[model samples]
Target: MRSRVLGSVLFGLGILALVFAGGLAFVVAPAAARLPYDMERTQSVAEAPNAQFLQITNGVAKVDTGTLRSTVTVQPDAKTTADLEGDLDGSALVWLVGQEVVRTDTNEVVSAYSTSYAVDRQTAAARDWNGQWLDTGSNRQSVKYTGHMYKFPFGTEKKSYDIFDRDILKAQPARFVKTEEVGGLETYQFVQEITNGRQDLPKDRLDAILGQLMPGATSGSVAYANTRTVWVEPTTGQYIRVQEKQSKTLVGNTGQSVTLLDALFTYTDDTVAKSADAASANRQKLLLVGVWGPLALALLALLLIIAGAILVTRRAAPTTAPRHAHPRHAADEDETAPIR
Candidate 1:
């Protein structure tokens, strides 16, 4: 009886554990992968050495060569996300991003701008709503932003993904190059390149370069191109390291060209270390809950169920009763009666 009770208790507990395991695998894992609302961190500065860029000196646009640094910051917009409705309330994360480029040698500001965009928390894809530029040539322009901009989705696959290009103001396909390791963590490498894509400059900035760069040029254009590469941790979809080669050219109405920018920038060592640490920690947590925990619980449940069944079946099986012989007198009387 005691064995039956213990077995029944273990069986019930095992069933409960099995249900929890399913919930963790199917439900909790997804929720755990979401981007937190308070992820407002400033990234480390990206630096380019021996870079050439256009700079204005005494009201003249001319080419200058120096070291350049790009600083980026991202913060969650509390006011915007607080009022999200319908499918966006719990599913979307609104972020404000700002970029500043400067010449490190002369301490001259090259460019600065800010933008607002919303992305799905799960997929990290930009949505159409709440997307517009600020303080740049494209300020307040209606932009049709699509694809992954800031981060990749969790469990990133070995396939091409659309990434938003800032200069082109559109999404372009970033092809997977190969699998690589970053700081002892496995990651996927993706490469994106843009060739001769035209970009709009502020009217004043464009006007200054028209006659300065080319003679007899009224309407001019700026062509932009970039080759971007990133190493992203697959489990958390966080970038461990990144590099970009950017080039820009000024085109006169008669097709005369002048080089505006030619630079190759890479992430700082500190940034890569921080990213790798974060990814490693998150990856471990996800594995514990989704894979290891569920598997262990399932195994325990099987063991408990089998033990319970064995105990219950043994108790329920039929057994023969033992026969006993009577004492001397009773045996003699029974023997005579049995003969008749």
Candidate 2:
């Protein structure tokens, strides 16, 4: 009896272990492998005339799930233009321009305007609340810029900027993780590591810029990061959406930290294709579905492993003795005794 019980326990544990191992192989590993890898390609692509201009329309709303509050949105239609200066060696600049337009739903003009600039192999620049332009320059060239925005009563804003320094063309180290389909478009995802500045410009300042762009962000300096897939039109190399989360950290009177998440930007293609070939290429890659395919397979494998384990344990265990065991045995002995 004890041996049987021990076997049952061992079998149960073995089955559980097998289930966990199967999950690791099918569910966890594959999903991890499917993460997007486009960001790295975006960074390395030759500058050439690869700049794409897009228009974005977005909206925001608040959602509650139990005790959690989330800000969800159809992000705003902010126009973006990426200009590749020359050949592969030249700098590529991406501009996010905020414009005034009538909201079809409300028919009101939104007053806020913002802009972001990315220089090839250098830091990005954007206007902050205090009217000071924040510049994140590259280390090699020491490239730096100062910008000022002029807002007119007519609801249009113009940004004038000058480069103060030049940085060397040392590309930051990055890796492509996965490819995904977002909003009917294929996207590439990448992870990058950026080095912080010393002395006057430090790591905290660099981290602040990313924090402002990301949602639920904390830590003055960011080490590991998460980003939604970046959708790119394959032929034209234009970005379809740049999904980011905005986070605000506040220190309460009790010295506790509070965080908030806000959707940042979603850009769509508004440019007329130069030719039909380009449009066709973009459409063909739209439903690519590489990332999610692996994820689904992983989940299926996890479920199968769990079910198999349960079945095996049930089959390996013994069944209970028949209820008539004692009666049947006594009758057999009496018949064999021959009238004793």
Q: Which has the greatest TM-score?
A: 1
lDDT tens digits by residue: candidate 2, 1-340: 5545555555555556556555655665433322121221111110102111111124232221111111112121122222232331122233333333222233333222233433322222222222112233222212223331110111111221221211211233224455666445454443333233112325554344334434454434322222323334343334344432223233323334333222233333322122223334534443222334444555555565555455545544558965764466665767767554
Q: Give per-residue CA lDDT, model 1, range 1-340, as digits (tens).
A: 7678877887887798899889889998888888877765646568999999988766788899999998888788978887777888888888888888899977888877777888888788887675444556345666667898768998999999999987788889999999998877999999999897989877876887887878788889999999999898988888888899999999888878899999999888888888898889989998988899889989988888888766655665457975668546766757657643
The 10-residue segment with the lowest total lDDT in model 2: 148-157
**Model 1 alpha-carbon miss at residue 279, Å:** 1.3
lDDT of 1 at 335: 65
- Highest-lDDT candidate: 1
Q: For each candidate, C-alpha RMSD in Å? A: 4.8, 21.8
What is the number of residue pairs that collide in model 2? 29
After aligning candidate 2 to the native by TM-score, how far in Å is the CA of 221 from where it should be? 12
Error of 2 at 292 (Å): 32
TM-score of each: 0.89, 0.27
